[model samples]
Target: MPSPFTLAITGQSLIHHDIRACVDPGFLQIVEILKKADVAFTNFEGTILGRHGGSPMKGSYFGYSDPQVLDALKQAGFNALALANNHAFDLGPPGILSTLEEVRARGFLHAGIGLDRDHAIAPGVAAIRSRLIGLVAMDAGPGPRTMYADNARYRRPSRPGVNQLEVTRIFEADRAAFDMLATIQTTFQISKLERANYAQPDDPPVLDEDAEIDFYGTIFRRADVNRRVIAVDPDSASIHLEAIARARSREQFVIAYLHHHHWEPNWRDVPDWVRAFAHACIDAGANVFVSHGTPVLQPIEIYKRAPIFFGLGNFIFHTEKGETEWSSPDVWKSVVATCAFDPAGPLQIDLLPVALGGEERIEGLDFHERQVPMVASGKIAQQIIDDLAERSAIFGTTIERHGPTGRIQVSEGQR
Candidate 1:
């Protein structure tokens, strides 16, 4: 049983959600559960910086909780956090800088994003029970040019900066022909893009090919790794390689948390490019691939000897419309809507929340911890376990339950 290393993991995003609430009981619950664990980890969902005067993204919101949040985590007995999720850069460079500062100040280890290209690509290391554990964080692909961390305490990058990867795929069979047609179409899309002295190709699918090929071709060519027009999306092969490299380092074990957005359940809705992106992560030596951004809980599957827990859902979304996805039956509806659940199986993870009023609390927080457990009591926990078990059955994975309290270990050799 691998020495029965007691592990109690929670999936809570660190965005500003009811931050001022009391959380002593919640922290104590975690301390009680993970007392014997060699290490404990949580998902730092939001960027940790004070909301200074920084421009938020055009189509999104930026956030920053007080630096004390990191202290709250330390008090709760967490050793590390996966910082590679979607909202990591909600507030740009300043937020990123503050997040790093807070993490360092708290003597906690974080990974998945960094100050510059080099730092962002690097992995994080922490010592737990004398065992060195390596942590790596990555985004799905490239993002806007105007994104970054911007805190007054830290210096910002002067050049055009982007932290996400932008990758596309092409099938070997469609390469040469697709390229020929795409070149012509590319000329038509932007007449100025064509070289004045260059002769445009007179191909059958000139317009169609040019439109498809030009966009995909240019992007793929940027990295110079694409051959045929197989897929189109921002999935960076370089980041995948980096993750692989980081995981290969000598450590007790390597766990990577990547920020990607592929949470569709419909077989047809599941894009081929999305699967390819996930495959790239798996190929990169990632042991556990935790995905976010779909904002819903997906199935837990083992891919290429690694356990991939897609869409851990939102852990601490203060901005949610009302109740959390877990508190609402809609999550279960989505679970059943996309996949089936096994009644006689264990739960996927120990779903825990960061309750309020502990060592990590702000002076103004009014959060109450007693109400949280009362809301998710034994009966509710049992229901969640049953629901998750049934869903696991659909993926040929068995999730059995030996009791309640939202603690169900996924037995091996059951698929």
Candidate 2:
């Protein structure tokens, strides 16, 4: 039988500062958990500013980290990183290239943004003790198209960007609302202007009498009731699945990851579309599926013996001190999941609750001391596990609590 392998997974790491010098007991405890695992994975949430110097693509919200932060993550025992996210292109193409260079130089197994379309979509593979682990990562965005990588064509050059899984937001309207929108469109002669200037030759065909109308770039579909629907482009999804399948065929334990900004009205609620896509990834031979975008933890699902984490929230969030958007306590509380896979036995997942600074006043701490995750205990730990259990129950995933930790055991028969 193959030897047992343990994988430690954490959420987004938007770290900008170094913490290798910190001797906090709580912080060190969190690091110890990661060190015990054969492989530890987290999403690197920002671009590394390196030799290929680049300019910021956004205003103050732009995310660019110094190279020393990579050293900090390595010190924290993270061996695998997912680099596909909204902020991956904060410093533009140069940032992508620089990050790729820095991560590769450190001997880290990283995937997501790459030199071109094919490279971005390819899996990052590395051999652990007794298993080969592969990571296929992507971003489903509400971001600019320029942020995504594309292949070199006859005339255009390849773009160095994130591996993008195209997603379309369709607004569903009732018959009356649909007709009113069409009337407004015709009255303003918007179609004429779009056809003459805005619409591309490859744009989806628009028919006045059809059930769907392309109002500018947004799609409005006629349906029985008014609602919003998130649609994943079939071709884009197929491409990602193909990469996962290819990696699995190579006998690698595949971990499929997605980073997206499309959240439900309630940040903690998992979107149906995302759940469906996670299942599709498991169907395509992904041994584990994880996602991180929303700053709060969502739900978990166990499908076909594979664990699916809809959103793992923030592991190491180092946002600006003045940023009040992440003030919610839920955003600061999350769990570190460790999955143990034994070839001759069952799969066991242990969850250790953690708090980012643990109810401390954000204004009191220095930049270096703030936003670092520590192991949670007592009431804080119970609260985190209870919330996670309640949400995960929606997907029929049961979590048994043991003191401050949670556990989920899947028998071999489930596989």
Taking all chains together, each candidate's TM-score versus the true structure is 0.65, 0.94
Q: Give the alpha carbon lDDT tens digit for every residue of 1-415 in model 1.
A: 1122333444545545333344545434545554445666667777765543234643534555666676655655666777765666666666776677778777666776676765766678776655566776666533433453222334743421224554433333246655655565566664434522232321111223333433322422222343434343334566545666666645335666656554345321233455565566667665455655554455566555445555555444454343332343322211111111122442244443232222223222233221221113344445655665566556554555556433334544343
Clashes of each: 48, 0
Among all windows of 10 consecutive residues in model 2, the one with the lowest summed lDDT is 359-368
Expressed as tens digits, the lDDT of each residue in 144-192 for candidate 2 is: 7788898999998999999999988889999999999999888988855
The candidate scoring highest on lDDT is 2
State the C-alpha lDDT per candidate: 0.49, 0.89
Give candidate 2 regions above 4 Å deviation. 192-209, 361-369
